[model samples]
Target: MKSQRFLKFYQSESEKYHGLRYGGLYGKLFKTLHHEALSGFLVQADNSEPILEIACGTGHTTGLLVKEGFDVIACDLTPGMMQRVSEQTGDQHEKVSFVRMDAFKLPFPDACVSTVVSTRFLHLFPADEQELIITEMYRVLKPGGVVLVDFDSWVHRWCWALPFALYNLLRYQRLAPYSIYNRIGRTITMASRVGFSDIKVDGIGGAQLLLPALISGSTALKVGRMHRRSVLRLIADQFMVCGKKY
Candidate 1:
């Protein structure tokens, strides 16, 4: 199955994966952008109740939630990723529990969790699967509980589309690309249909729009850093959608 294949891939490439995605210079920049945009909402989360982090991916955001004083259940599909989370959390492991589970089928009961958060995971699936995953998150949340999720955005699709298309063509020998971009309108609509209300969305990581300069080793990093807080944030590479189940 595709799930098993991805699990093995993560297990084998865990180190390189995080290094490239969150540890490198560009990776750090991306993380800082994401953190700035999401921290406000996260800090305001109800810490008195238990939180579930689906597809936690080695506890990048899980560690943040734990440090913010939330009891976190960090769930991922790969044992290798969970092992990395154990190593990352260290003594804080007492406040964080790691579980291997599918996002489409969480093990928790309905209304058991006060908060559900996922990042950089949902956009990987097809539309139907994305809906199922969102519905699953909704199903396990308590009434009025919050669901925060991140997605790749189509706002600046023109910037990365060519590279992604070429990469897909060469790598898979097909035109199928790996990443999906969601429109803000569609994202909000999907959440409403999933029974969430008071929906809010924010854009982040506009540095990706300068991908050409970044690739050319130009002033893209400096420019991205300077303009990150400007109105250009509206055309960011990724978005976070927050909604409450009412």
Candidate 2:
């Protein structure tokens, strides 16, 4: 039921997604921060195997991965999103392969890819489901493989919590916000249970992330400084949880 709703939502809005998330000056600002946050994790992925990206909405990240010369298997449940990736890939077809996939049931063989990345996607599910996602990611990843996932910060969402929960409860009948949090302890435990090692969270996009685009240039710069202090983790807009499957 929940899966169907997500599929329908993405399928319907695939074409509009890029413009909404990566459009205006604000969009561009967030996009650059997003890339910077995810780039380090990308390099952590071994080049011996192709990088697997799950729930790659509209290929915004796909374009980045390919541009950096990594062969990627970008997977999304929605065909519309996959089509957009196809279009976004343009002449760089050989660098990426599109796969229509249900993350719970990745089509590839066991221990196939060296790295599995899914960002801005896992926080939608509850604690149990988030573990399920980590478990599934563990399955397809090679031993010592890297897995990087981003979560929406609970502190950052506090002001909007009511509307966020109300909207989800009303629209899809689900308000699974377990992954939206200020600390990485629980997430570390969640991933560790599934045989992940060296788990930690990295702060990206500060609380001022919602500010106007004109101010974002300096705000993005602040992310590096913000990440150094653990206290600021509460206000960060997103947290990147990175670990290795061992």
TM-score, model 1 to reference: 0.85
Listed per candidate, the RMSD to the true structure in angstroms reads 3.4, 3.4
The segments of candidate 2 whose C-alpha lies over 4 angstroms from its true place after superposition are: 159-183, 223-230
Best-matching candidate per lDDT: 1
The residue-by-residue lDDT of candidate 1 on 1-246, one tens digit each, is 878877887788677666767886666667766766567677647889868999888777877777677888889998877777765566787898777898878998888888999988988887778889999999999887899998887866666667767867886677764567888788889889989998877767654634645565345545554444556655777888889987
Model 1 RMSD in angstroms? 3.4
Off-target runs (Cα >4 Å) in candidate 1 are 165-177, 208-231
RMSD of 2: 3.4
What is the lDDT of every predicted structure here? 0.77, 0.76
Candidate 2 lDDT over residue span 134-186, tens digit each: 78899999898999888877677786677668857875579953244534667
Give all TM-scores, in the order shown: 0.85, 0.85
